[model samples]
Target: MNRNALIAAMIMALLGGFLLFAYLKKFEEEASGGAPVKLLVARKHIEPGTVVTDDMLATRVVPAAYVETRAVREAEKARVVGLRLATPVQAQQTLLWTDLAITADDKRDLSSLVQPGMRAVGVRAANDDKSFALMRPGDRVDVIATFPIEGSTQRQSIVLLQNVMVLAVGLDTTAIDTSKQGGSPSSQDLLLNLSLTLPEAQLLSLAAEKGRISVALRNPDDVRITDSLADLNSNLLTDSKTRKTVQDFRKTPTGPVKLPSAAGAQ
Candidate 1:
């Protein structure tokens, strides 16, 4: 064949092969629902009310035909990053918009925000204690507990929990709504929702029932956990130097406060 003729024949053969491949691919996809589409999925089991973060999410390849509108698409994955989850999701399960804690759909339940394997604990503070009022969601604080000791009539103040995160202030995790500005916090609602492990929650519950617990506000950037802490017991409460020591201690890590000795108490 001439050069022009040969080139035209080769082009036609190549075009035919490409068309056949495309047809087969389309048929396969049709049989299997549709083309693979990107979807957002849980990398691990995520608890409800827990703030969604980058690490907890993963992309999944799902058939386009099977994807629901509620499921988050890969194109919109960034939308969920800073939002909280409204419902618990198992590992590898698809994430839906309904699962997110947004607007009126957001559940008032604190359990949704508790991290997987962790527990939500509400630690009561004294009404006049202004520390908890200053604590917002995501702020970390150390918990201090004051209780009467067996040997002493004076109450002992000891550091209970360290570097703990505040989940919510009186069931309102975000902050005081702009609409609620005119309203004042009621005396009966002194509960602060705190994220804690099972054991920590148990300890805190007992402390709230038996003694008084207080929130020691923490700086968002500071994460240092003090290795050595001197309990502020009878001797320190009476000592004049303790005033300075207590002031210094207030700036440290914050957490759920409970009496460590509660289990053995009479």
Candidate 2:
């Protein structure tokens, strides 16, 4: 071979070796950087329809090259639904190109006890002097019936329903806007809808036949924990001091005896 050609071949081999060495070094630097990213989770388990929040991010592990402040920020906004609780996640859960937050309001009324097949009556009454001033929907109440029983000398006030839900207070269950109505509605008129059981409906009907029925507001903390009739009667009896008073009054009568006057008087 010519001397010039041999020299040129040796130079080309040297340049190729240097380029290969540089490429291998660069690959090694990337491999040794850090642990692969592991996606962090918010809660151990979540139900369906739950919105993802910022607190549910996994930040400890990430790809060495992909780990950047911008990437982390973008990932914080990502939301995923299939994340079962306690499942290990990866960088795939992160949001890379979207700006959004997952959220929803799930408030519900816990007072309504009306169920299918249950017999209920709709009752209405006034709260304040104005019909609009009274009770609101979702409020709990005790229904009292004042009636005279057959052969009884006096009237009795009995509780017909306990922990009853007030489904509405006026003509509307929500609210009535007088301005939208073009004129003010009567203030003294109010209406209420209530749920009742079969026996309760019978009792209410019988009592209503004899006298007036009214509703007594109950404490908000009072909850219907039991449906035991005996317990209810016991509670009602305990609350009534009138029965004891009446028994005592009957035992002692105020009058004068006239047996001796019949024998001695002219």
Candidate 3:
């Protein structure tokens, strides 16, 4: 072979080797970077405030580059199982930390929802009050107490607390637990959790212990403070002709004077 042809052949061989080495390096980098990572995704449409369950989640293999920092991994399914969702997540969408209603540490205790310096007091629901069954977290309510008067057999219903924020409806802060009954009699009882001030909590605790406690649902937009001192009495509905006359007796100079009692005598 000619010297020039031999030299060109050697150069072409070296060039080809260099291109092969570059191609191999690029393939190696792609192989190293394109690994699949497992991410937790919602198996079905999960509404906000719905409790996450194992069946509602599925593992999805996605490119590592697409995995977000806040994305929950398949291994974290156990931790997310009982947690609530703060926002709705579509089916097959990746579950993220921000999508959760509460943090992992705060899921067990809903005190985080209570305003700072407020108390979370749970009052027992009256079996007859079906409104408790419809309540949800973040709802507003009026706490009503029904118990007999100190010396009378007549039951009196009073508004013990007003415009109270409902921290939870049932034991599980996320779900409506109609099965959990808990009144004075087990069958008639359900728990209604509320957020109140210290004094309001004390009042509610006493009311719950002394009488049957019931909650009246309020409109979320209706935060109007009710200063009503009126107490409801069943006698108001009874026929006036058959109702017994109540008199307010007071001491007087001549003798004890009597006057007609108010509609509801406190």
What are the lDDT scores of the predictions, listed in order?
0.73, 0.49, 0.71
lDDT of 3 at 156: 83
TM-score of each: 0.52, 0.37, 0.46
Best by lDDT: 1
Give the winner by lDDT: 1 or 2: 1
Worst 10 residues of 3 by lDDT: 246-255
Best-performing candidate as measured by TM-score = 1
Please give the lDDT score for candidate 2: 0.49
Which of 2 and 3 is the better model by TM-score? 3
Clashing pairs in 3: 182-189, 182-190, 183-189
- 57-158: candidate 3 lDDT, tens digit per residue: 999997664554446788777878888888899999999765787642454456645545677887766557565656766677877898988777678889
Candidate 2 matches the true fold with a TM-score of 0.37
